[model samples]
Target: MTELLGIPPQLLFGQLLLGLINGSFYAVLSLGLAVIFGMLNVINFAHGALYMTGAFVAWLLLSYLGIPYWAALVLAPLVVGLLGILLERTMLSRLYKLDHLYGLLLTFGLALIIEGLFRNAYGVSGQPYPIPSWLQGGFNLGFMFLPVYRGWVVLASIVICFGTWFLIERTRLGSYLRAAVENPQLVRAFGINVPLMMTLTYGGAVALAGFAGVLAAPIYQVNPLMGQQMIIVVFAIVVIGGLGSIMGSIVTGLGVGVIEGLAKTFYPEGSATVVFVLMAIVLLLRPHGLFGRTRT
Candidate 1:
C-alpha cells in the first residue's frame, strides 16, 4: 500500500475525513455559542442541551409525525429555535443587565434539568438514527472510502459556517447585530428593535445548534449524554478561537478536528488530551485567541 510519511494512505486519509466531519459539527455548534456570547454577553451553558434537544426533536418528528429526515432537518431547528426565543423572552432577557455568572448558572441548571428529564424518560441507552435513504452510500476515493453522509456533513458545514459568518459580519442585519452588541442603546435610538433583535439573535443561535444536532443524528447514537460529552470540547474551541470571533470559531473548529483526527492515528493515548493541552498552550501564549479581538 502506498504510504505517506511512513503511514498507509488509507489510515491517514480515513482519519482526515473523519476529522473534517467532526470539524463540521464543531463549526456549527461553536458558531452558535460565539454568536450568543458575543451578542448577548450571556454564557449559555444550556447550548449542549439545546443541541441534544434538536436531535431528539428530529427523532420524535420522524417517529411520531412520520416526518422524513429531510423535513425533520428544517422542522427540528425551527421548533427548538422557537422554544429558545420563548426562553429568551421569558427568562434570559431578564438577566442581560446582570452578571454573566447568573446567566451561566441558570443555563447550567437548565442543562442538568433537561438532561435529567430525558434520562428519566428515555433511560441512559443510546438510540439509533438511520441514515436517510438518499444519503446511504459511499464514494471510492481509491486511497480511502468516503461515506456519502460524511461528505455531505463537510459540505453542509462549510456552507452553514460561511453563511453564518456572512450573516454576522457582512450583511445589514449582521451590522445592526454587531452594533447592538456594542451599543444597544445607540442602535435603539436609530429606531431598530434592539430587544426583539436580541431575542431573535438568541433564537437563531440556538437554531444553529439544532441544525448541527440533526446532522449528527445519523452518525452517532442519539442519547441524552451526547451533548454533555460534546459541550466541553466545544467550549474549549470557543475559548481557543477567541470569544466573539465567528471566523475564528469556524477555522479553529476545523483545525481542532483535523488535529484530533490525526492524533488518533499518531498518538492514540494522547488523542483525548490533545485539545485541552492545546487550549492550555493557547491560553498561555495568546490570551485573546488566534483570531479573537481583545476586549477594549
Candidate 2:
C-alpha cells in the first residue's frame, strides 16, 4: 500500500475528500452569515434552522410533490428564501434599531421554534435522499476512489463561492450592499431603498444556506438535526476567518476541513476537538480573526 508520511494514501486522500466536502458546506453557510452580518448587523443565529428548512423542503418536494432533485435544488431555496424574507419583515426588521443582541436572541428563539416543529413532525431519525442517477458512482484516482458526487460538490462550491465573492467585491450592486451596510441613511439619500435592500440581502443569505442544504442532501441523511452540528463548526470557521470577510470565511472553512481530515488520519481521537483548538489559537493571536477588519 502506498503511504504518505507513513500513513496510507488511501486513508489520507479519503479523509481529505471528506474534509473538502464538509468545508464546502461550511463555506456556503458561512457566506450567508457573513453577508447578513455585514449588511444587517445581525448575527442570525437562526441560520442553521433555515438550512434545515431548506433540506426539509427539498425532501418534502421529492416525497410529496414528486419533484426531481434538479428541480428541488432550485425550488427549495426559493421557498426557504421567501420564508427568510417573511421572518425578516415580520420580526427581524423590527429589531434592527434595537440592540444587536436582541436580534441574536430573536433569531435564536426562532431556531428553537423551527427545530422543534421539525422534530415534532419528523422525529429524530434521518431520512434518506437518493443520489441522482447521473452522479452515482466513484472514479479510481490512483491514490483513492473519488465519488463523482463529491467531486461535483467541490467544483460546484468553488464556483459558487467565487461567484458570490465577485458579486460582493466587484459589482455595483455589491457596492450598494456595502454602502447601505455601512451607512443606510447616506445610501438612501441617493434614492436607494435601503430597507428593501436589507430585506433582499437577508433573503439572499438565507437562500445561500438553502443552496448548500440542497447540495448536501444527497451526501448526508436529511434530518432535522443535520444543520445543528454543522452550524456550530461553521461558527468556529467564521470566527477563525473573521466576520464579514467573504474570502477569509471560504479559505478558513476549507483549511479547517483539511486540517480536521488530517487529524482524523493521524489521531482520530483528537479530530473532533481540533477545530475548536485552532479557533482558540486564532482568537488569541489575532483577536479579530485571520482576515477580519476593524469595523468603524
Q: Tens digits of per-residue lDDT for model 2 on 1-296?
A: 43536888888899999988988888889888888887888989999989988889999999999998899989998998999999999999998889889998999999999999999999999998899899899999898999999999889888888899999999999999998888888999999999999999899899989988889888888888988878888889888999888988889888888898888988899999998999999999998899998887
Counted clashes in each candidate structure: 0, 0
TM-score for each model: 0.97, 0.97
Residues 205-260 of candidate 1 have per-residue lDDT tens digits of 99999999999999999999999999999999999999878998999999999999
The residue ranges of model 2 lying beyond 4 angstroms of the native Cα positions read: 1-5
**How much lDDT does each candidate structure score?**
0.92, 0.90
Candidate 1 accuracy as lDDT = 0.92
Pairs that collide in candidate 2 are none
